[model samples]
Target: MKTIIKAPPRRKPQSAGATTNRPGNPATGKRLPYGLADCVIFLAIAIPLLIAMCATGRPGA
Candidate 1:
């Protein structure tokens, strides 16, 4: 006479809900890439800055 044995069951794959499991928000207070580094210096006068230039000729015309 002979004896019989049983086999174990296989495991199923992970579901969809288990994939997206994030903790918290990362971008709380982030700085810009070009923060004041890329600026421009504009010069008002061209040839000579005279005292007469201070007076607005038209006065906000």
Candidate 2:
């Protein structure tokens, strides 16, 4: 006598509208307020360069 084995059923592919099972929106809130910190950091790096350029005179001179 031969034995017959059946495979388990497969799950359906998730639909585009199936967000309920997904995690909360990645951009739910102001996750990265990029203004103040970015400006401060940019200025922190830029102001020194600007002062150095002014103190050293024109470039390639």
Candidate 3:
């Protein structure tokens, strides 16, 4: 009988304070603004919360 073992995947090491997902990629010093998709998503979630707050006593009410 034989058993097979799998090794865990390896990950690249990132320096502390990694800002890969920030408004700008600090690591590469590149400016990247939010795309239209990001804006749409923000609005999709924000609008519902705003509407719920305005029409009700409070959130989860």
- Show where candidate 1 strays beyond 4 Å: 1-18, 21-23, 26-30, 39-61
lDDT of 2 by residue, 13-59 (tens): 98889847544776665466587889899999999999998998976
Error of 3 at 16 (Å): 37
Q: Which ten residues in a row have the lowest lDDT in candidate 2?
A: 21-30
Q: Which model scores highest in lDDT? A: 2
Model 1 TM-score is 0.21
lDDT tens readout by residue for model 1, 5-29: 7778877878998777665776656
Instruction: Flag the better candidate by TM-score, 2 or 3.
Output: 3
Residue 32 miss distance in model 2 (angstroms)? 10
Best by TM-score: 3
- Screening candidate 3 with a backbone cut-off below 3 angstroms (N, C-alpha, C), the clashing residue pairs are none
